[model samples]
Target: MRQNLLMIEDDARLASMVAEYLDQSGFTVAHAGDGHSGLARLAPDTGLDAPDLVILDLMLPDMDGLEICRRIRALPGAMGHVPVLMLTAKGDAMDRIIGLEIGADDYLPKPFEPRELLARIRAILRRKGEAPASNSKALRFGTLEIDRDARTVTVGGKPCDLTSYQFDLLVALAERAGRVLTRDQIMEAVRGRELEAFDRSIDVHMGRIRAAIEVDAKDPKRILTVRGVGYVFARQQD
Candidate 1:
């Protein structure tokens, strides 16, 4: 069966175009025009099959796309693992950062070519399975403990609930503890592919990770952002 896709965009014309394009590309498409309605369509009793991926627009009629993305990630079991690609008209660095911080798997700015959009979808799907094998490695730093095999992260011995994207971001940084990883390198390692500029998913995922692992999310000590460059995982000071 073709992979199912759920597209949430407020613009009806754009939604129809995207749905048609996705359908022609072999995806069974379901489109919703607002956040509330979109969520309703996704609910269990709808009898509509769950989608393999979600293309979410940041600007919705009722709710912010970030809120919807957060709610989707909070779903239990397999329902929560669906890949999300954020679509938006906001092209600024901060917008991208915010989207990533909110747990989006990828982001694409507006005015994108249909072909490029399709390519991105394909890349993201590939990454879903191609993420590097963890080998069950464990890294301990101060109050933080990361178990890659089980994909669990703990703070002060307490298990922290993290989405898969969050866990991957933390591991990518922790694996090279104390070293700087450029945004591109980090994105490749975490997303398993080359990504576009203004891709803030890394920052977003890191934000979530810091919130879970840091003693103080407001003033993060473990993951320090290097200006104009990337980030470093601050190992425990000996």
Candidate 2:
């Protein structure tokens, strides 16, 4: 099946080129020239079908693409959980970090080869797809429950609001509860890709996960950080 994608970019030429490239590569790509238009396309009441993923440009004519991403995440229901792949300027490490912190599933630097873009999109979708293939197994740690097939995390029976990427990250940690996974190991397990040097996106996602599952995110009890190292999911939690 051809996956549906919404590309929100201001550069007309780039949008056209990318849409064509992805279409030939077996994806249905819709183009939106600005942030408002992009968000509007994602509206549930709109006649348009919701996209499977979004390819958002960090720079837009009317609004910051980061704000658009935040709005997308703020949208109610499943619409808010749609995966987003951000396009950022090459070497703009900070922008990528900020993008991940605000819920982007992945990012590709600008002036990229379409092949890499395709790889990134496929990787993101693949990871997302792999999350729910566990025969509906549910991992229980105290009041925290992770439903693998449902791809959900609940604390004390209350649903936790987490983006798709964050949910997968949580699952990766919870699946290996009590292991001290380095940043690279966590990224590899969740992303199935090599970690870019100095990439702190994992840390940002971890912080987001803690906020959702920990009663006190400031002093997390479930996902613990090891200073000068990575993080570990406490096997014992209440």
Each model's lDDT comes to 0.78, 0.87
Model 2 lDDT on a 0 to 1 scale: 0.87
Model 1 scores what on Cα lDDT? Answer: 0.78
Rate residue 205 of model 2 by lDDT. Answer: 89
**TM-score, per-candidate, Cα-based:** 0.77, 0.94
lDDT of 2 by residue, 1-238 (tens): 8999999999999999999999998999889999999998998889666688999999898999899999999888778888999999999898988998888988888899999899888887887777363556799999999998888889899999887778888988888899999887887777645567777788888888998999999999999999888999999988
Cα-based lDDT at residue 47, candidate 2: 66
In candidate 1, residue 87 scores what lDDT?
Answer: 88
Off by over 4 Å in 2: 131-135
Which one wins on TM-score? 2
Worst 10 residues of 1 by lDDT: 127-136
